[model samples]
Target: MSRGFVKESDQEELPIIPPRAPLPAGVINYVTPTGLAALTAELNALEAEKADFPTDHEGEHRRAVAVIDGKLALLRPRISSARVVDPAAQPQEEVRFGARVTLRFGSSGREQTFQIVGVDEANVKEKKIAFTAPIAKAISGLWAGETADFRMGGKAEKLEVVKIRY
Candidate 1:
């Protein structure tokens, strides 16, 4: 005797909802609004263009679309990403996630500053670097005044952690 329903013999169907998978540990996940828009655009583009490519010759296109999807799938995580690290933290001499590092470019006569961020907030032009980046990996857990070397344009460059801010 279902309330306000049909006969008792009529079976009611329950709503179907899929369970989501848990995020992996230590994998930081965060994305700025800009990043979210960019990923959404990529998704739209992929969906729109995927049908245009011939099924027999869409290997490269398919892979590219898959990559975009993979990136979008990281909007959440089990372990918070370094990009979302607390910005209000006090400045420290040690290099770590969310630290803004100033490095002296070896090849060029200039100094470059980068905010060590998670992959979601990484915008090289904006001087935001992902913690998982080569330079970040090399500098992470190192104290200020420590120098790390990396190759750029096939030439070696030395970078010094001059300053860090929350």
Candidate 2:
């Protein structure tokens, strides 16, 4: 059992598993129905990949399976904790989770539209923002024609709600 008797080739390197998007402590894992479905799909894909690992090279196969397992380890809890919220069931009169809101910047008079979604589903390229984001927090529960002051980095900007849709 001495280190002098151990071989370097016998040691297995742990695969680096990337962390999922951050959800602040004690914050409920709220997810849209679509977001939940996407998480489930990702879990299924990882399971399939783990099962289909090639066995031609034993070490390679083991490393590949370990990586997939690590990913699944992180993903499973996220799926399990998901609380799906249906966009259609949300109140349409005010901005809430899953609401597609259009806002006009008071200073520039430029309009931008984005949907408030869960942390896991937030994608700026798709015009979706996390509910915990500063702008989303500032505008939540506001109705069309209402204004909210969004402050970031010690600077504040006025945002006017131009439209709200579920």
Candidate 3:
């Protein structure tokens, strides 16, 4: 059968799938207990949605299934490689993964709080930052009332750890 003989309507365009969140190479995929639970819930929801997809329109159904499968493919590895870290189990005296830290800036007398979490669970709106973030890395292992020099934009600013809680 020649391509010129085929109907144009028979050709199906592949669905575009979005990429997952970036995780740097060589870094372990660590997830808090809550983060792992959320991922599991998301996977289950996608599975249910795929299972309930309507089959009345064959092309639409196939495209929908393909998109869901793509998402599942990206998600499965994250879930499988996840190393769950319990926030409560961490040391309470110092900054570490899952620590909610309060920091004061030098000269400004201003304070801010952030929770150091896994890459999949980092949400700026919620004041949660990934453990790999520059600020998080700078402040890691510091005890309450300790200070660290944070460099940004070629300028160094002091960050004082006011409090640490798991």
Comparing 2 and 3 by TM-score, which wins?
2
Candidate 3 similarity to native, TM-score: 0.90
Better of 1 and 2 by TM-score: 2
TM-score, candidate number 2: 0.92
Candidate 1, residue 49: lDDT: 65
Q: All candidates' TM-scores?
A: 0.51, 0.92, 0.90
Clash count, candidate 3: 0
lDDT of 1 by residue, 26-97 (tens): 655544444445545655665566556556645555555555455445433322332334544534767777
Root-mean-square deviation of Cα positions for candidate 2 versus the true structure, in angstroms = 1.8
Of the two candidates 2 and 3, the one with more favorable lDDT, higher being better, is 3
| Model 3 Cα shift for residue 141 (angstroms) | 0.6
Q: Per-residue alpha-carbon lDDT of model 3 for 21-98, expressed as tens digits? A: 688998999899999998999899999999999999888898999999999999999999999999899989989999
Runs with alpha carbons beyond 4 Å of true place in candidate 1: 1-26, 30-84
Worst 10 residues of 2 by lDDT: 149-158
What lDDT is reached at residue 119 by model 3? 87
**Candidate achieving the largest TM-score:** 2
Worst 10 residues of 3 by lDDT: 6-15
